[model samples]
Target: MSTWTSRAALAGAALALSACTEQETGAAAPREVVVARGAVLVAAPPGYCVDRTALRDAEEGSFALLASCASLDPNADGPSAQPAILTVTVSGRDPETTPPRAEALAAAAPEAVLATRQRGALALVHLGDGGDAVLPGGDPRHWRGATGTGGRVVALALYAPRESPLAGAAGGDLMAALAARIEARAPATVAAAPPQARSGDGLRATLARLFN
Candidate 1:
């Protein structure tokens, strides 16, 4: 498929799967999560925590929702809590395939890419209004990054209210920071759940869950 086609396909799939939820991941520290058949280990950045109640591990892939630690745990005094909703999606990697490259992603959807930056080993793309092919209409502005983990491509996305750090130029730095800290662990057994890819009703629910 063409680059644009691949990019759209990915976004459409993610959009479709956004609404469907999953079981809690039990308690864990530093918020380390094994997901996507173990293709990715989502480690919450400082002051943030994984929302166990909002996770998906199924045939479609692994999805983790992240929020300020203070929001998830009333007792925690998250001094650095960021005003943003972060998500990580781990697309199961085929042994025969390589992780998506930074340049490749930028190239895939040029019209939407506002800026591309190389952060450590991560290449981040800042999307313009309605630009992110990953989650359209959810946020006018967002950041996206991809990296290889456990033979899979870990997709990172950040959405924040206007005037928030995650919605400005600093977004790339945040994305890179989170990317550098993420690690890959042993593949966990796939959950016996239905496909996260859902119907039109689910899509509307997803938009509400995300934008509201």
Candidate 2:
């Protein structure tokens, strides 16, 4: 080929590559949110938000995170029904083996215990009638689950107004669903820490907090 033609072809190829790079650089990235002691994560659900400000520190070994689906839209003018709350708690480094759902419920000294049942994939221990005020604000319902996998154990609970759609069988099913989402990424040894993948600034910061 002629020198002029070869030069022209190479220049065109370079321009095309630069354009591709620019397009990729400007593309939006996927969104993600972490939950349940950072053991479970899912793509940030649309219209759902997490409230981190009220994270409960029951003790050095225990903490809870709450997520809500409350509507933030201002245009809708109508009665605002109570929003559903999903609460997840993690209990770390407990010397005692994880307790059975029944045992945990009995230990709580609840005013009354209800029959144990499976909802979705989780067997839940009903804490008590939602009227007991075990939850803040005298909430109507509370339920608990103890899930262990890969030698890591986490106890999860959900507190909601009795009127919530997720208050009954639905709540149990939701608890089961969330529990199943826990990732078994617990490091088997100190030397086996997972390598951090380079990510965008936001993801990098989120992961730092999660893993640290």
Candidate 3:
């Protein structure tokens, strides 16, 4: 038997709910869902300090926005099934390949299916299957793709279970809304540096290196 897992699955539920209500109007409705004020601080991966205030937890699931003054994971070799900075991942069993399965899953739900890319044996799907009128980078799922300034910002990812209460709820607008909340709270800039360079020798040395 094949297994499948997606970190975005939980977050995708919010998209399903939002998509259900917004399909016709193409506008997300106000949610009765009460969100806590300020961002919730969570321990981020080493070498990166995430804005916990960027986190938005709802009954559907949760979304977190991260800002790295330095690199989130300088040595992150490639995508892993495990959760890492700024990436939503899913791993499990399925007869189909990653992209096809991801496409089918997104289609079944109210998600906005974005493009798919193959990473070795895995297929990575970049989607905007949530609420929020404007994502960090405009909707990649759209035909035109991103434009101008939207091209520079990193994309905010969403996840959803193949079959869950949140799946196919709405057009995934709520998920977008959740993403918007996170984006609204994210830092304006993430400094760039050479791949092998460190922000500060001490800071780099003390930083916990993940993805071993």
Which lDDT tens digits does candidate 2 get at residues 7-76? 2222322332233233233232222344333443432233333333323333212233333333322222
Compare candidates 2 and 3 on TM-score and give the better one. Answer: 2
Judged by whole-model lDDT over C-alpha atoms, candidate 1 comes out at: 0.58
What would the TM-scores of all predictions be?
A: 0.66, 0.52, 0.25
Candidate 2 root-mean-square deviation in Å: 20.5
Best-to-worst lDDT order: 1, 2, 3
Task: Give the TM-score (vs. native) of candidate 2.
Answer: 0.52
**Alpha-carbon RMSD, candidate 3:** 17.8
In order, candidate lDDTs are 0.58, 0.41, 0.27
Per-residue alpha-carbon lDDT of candidate 3 for residues 1-212, written as tens digits (9 for 90 to 100): 01122234323433433333333332222211222122112333332333232335531123443323132223323222221123211111111211223333334334445554332222234444442222222222311010001112112233323332222333133233323333212232211211132244221121111000
- lDDT winner: 1
Candidate 3 — which residues are off by over 4 angstroms? Answer: 1-48, 56-63, 70-100, 109-114, 118-123, 127-132, 136-212
For model 2, the superposed segments whose C-alpha errors exceed 4 Å read 1-48, 55-62, 71-82, 94-96, 118-123, 130-139, 186-212
Clash number by candidate, in order? 0, 1, 33
TM-score of 3: 0.25
Please report the candidate that would top TM-score against the real structure.
1
